[model samples]
Target: MPLTFHWFLPTNGDSRDVVGGGHGSPATVSGRDRPPTVAYLSQIARAAEDLGFVGALTPTGAWCEDAWLTTAMVSQNTQRLKFLVAFRPGFVSPTLAAQMASTFQRQSGGRLLLNVVTGGESQEQRAYGDFLDKDDRYRRTGEFLQVVRGLWEGQTVDLVGEHLQIEGAKLARVPDPVPEVYFGGSSPIAGKIAARHADVYLTWGEPPAAVAEKIARIRGLAEKDGRSVRFGIRLHVITRDTSEQAWAEARRLLDGFDPETVRAVQAGLARSESEGQRRMLALHGGGSDALEIHPNLWAGIGLVRGGAGTALVGSHEEVAERIADYHRLGIDEFVLSGYPHLEEAYWFGEGVLPRLRTQGLWQHPFDTRTPPSAQVPFAGAATAR
Candidate 1:
């Protein structure tokens, strides 16, 4: 299968410097001056659409804007691009979530994909009125997906699971094309949920070997459930015309980091109960040095950012090669973002995607209708201010 690429909508904000306040942080912080306006997010959506990316992932959390509402408004701005809306299963009732997804699909013309984020941090989840521990949250997510899946399948679900009890729940009109579920977790309970329910198992950008090990783990678990799941990696990218330019850009972003801010964010994230977040912290150890953990993979983002801290930093060709390496390791989808998302979208879209297309690794999702020449260029595309 040709690799599917998705860009991220920085609902928190975008900046030339790495943004802070992700999963376990105090608040959404874009250290740079830019604010996350609807107009700005729409520009990103349009850019990702024009660049042949299949969708844009809108995150959900206290740190960022609401994914469901943000994506709904953004979806109105783009015709073909999908929105992988990140939502927590425990925050909202499963029936309502299913109905909202159905409404979103109908309104957006089937442009809804679900990213089920079972809240990882107990303190953060408590702020949203959820007191479940990490393990119980995963259990709730498993039950939540089951109910939501049943509703989407046109069943009158009356599941009385330990975490969820939906009585005679049924959607008035089922979603025409059921949205695919994208989920990620590193804990044992998380693996079970992904194995049983996820259409795509997502992971933060890890080295190829680590990614392969994760894929093998999920594949084995899913096989036991008599199911199959695709794999995806969420990453930041710093692709440029040359390797020197890309690394230079990476260094510039690194240089912008305030040492005190790094220490503060790292200290806060160290309290995270999430295994995935712990792993991300381990990759960089909240330091500004030795960011290039692998040949083209940079772990500088995690210095402040919470979720996906690693980036693929290299020339266009080198970035494409790393993507191919991940593809060979069974990563079918790539959910990518970068600092100052709009410009980075152009850099990767114009410089790197073309190379992937030429290498037979990717094709524009709407290539049959929109020709390459007619497509908008990311560099000069109007981000209507």
Candidate 2:
């Protein structure tokens, strides 16, 4: 299948300088400037749409602006782009969640895609007065999805699971096209939940080998359930006109990181019980050195970002090569973002995507009318004898 690409909205604020605070971290002052205004986020969304991205992921957490609201407002600005709204299942009742999704789908013309984030950090959950531990939270997510799925299917749900008790929960109007559930977790329980529930299983930007291993693990569990699920990988991307320009940009982003801030953030991330967060910390060891863990794959983002700490950094061709490598390993969807979201969208959209199209690996999801070869520069090259 042709690959699908998605961009990210830095609703947490963005700048040329590194913007900190993600996952468990409190919104830290980078001492840099940039506010996450709706206008700015809409700009990024519009750019992604123009660039042929299928969707834009609005992250959910205490560190960023609310994903639901941000995406809802931003959706009004773009015509063909979907919003992969990241939201925790535990924070809201399943029935209401279904209603919100239905309403969003109607309002946005089926442009809503949900990313189910089972809260990973206890401290952050507690801040919201949710005291469930990691395992219990996963249980809640399972129950939550059960009820929400039933409601979305136009059934009156009366589910009495261990973590949820919904009596007669139903949506008066079912969503015409039920939103696809995008989920990620590294724990054993997480794998089980994903196999049982997810339409698309998501993972952070791990190396190709690691991603393949994870895919195998998920496949094993999914086979037991007799169901198949697609896979997606999320990462930051830094593409430029040339490989040298890309690496220089990567180095500049690394240069701005304060060692003390790295230590402080790593310490906080280290306390996280999330296996995914732990894996991210191990990638770069919270250091500024040796960030190129693999060719065109930089671990520098791990120095401060909690989730998806690595990035695909290189020229458009190199970035396309790495993406194809992942695609070969069974990644059909990519959720990519970069520092200063708007500009990076242009870089990746104009740069790597054309190359992927030339290789016959990708086609725009929203532009079914436009023939692929017509839109892609190297399409004729691909067909040449």
The TM-scores of all predictions, comma-separated, are 0.96, 0.94
Model 1 agreement with the true structure over 24-95: per-residue lDDT tens digits: 887757574677888999998888888889989998888888888888888877789999999998888999
Compared with the true structure, what per-residue lDDT tens digits does model 2 show for residues 265-284? Answer: 89988998999988888888
For every candidate in turn, the CA RMSD to the true structure comes to 3.5, 6.1
Best-performing candidate as measured by lDDT = 1
State, as a TM-score between 0 and 1, how close model 1 is to the true structure. 0.96
Which residue pairs clash within candidate 1? none
The CA lDDT at 290 in model 2 is 81
Poorly placed runs, candidate 1 (over 4 Å): 371-385
How far residue 46's Cα lies from its native spot in candidate 1, in Å, is: 0.5
**lDDT value for candidate 1?**
0.90
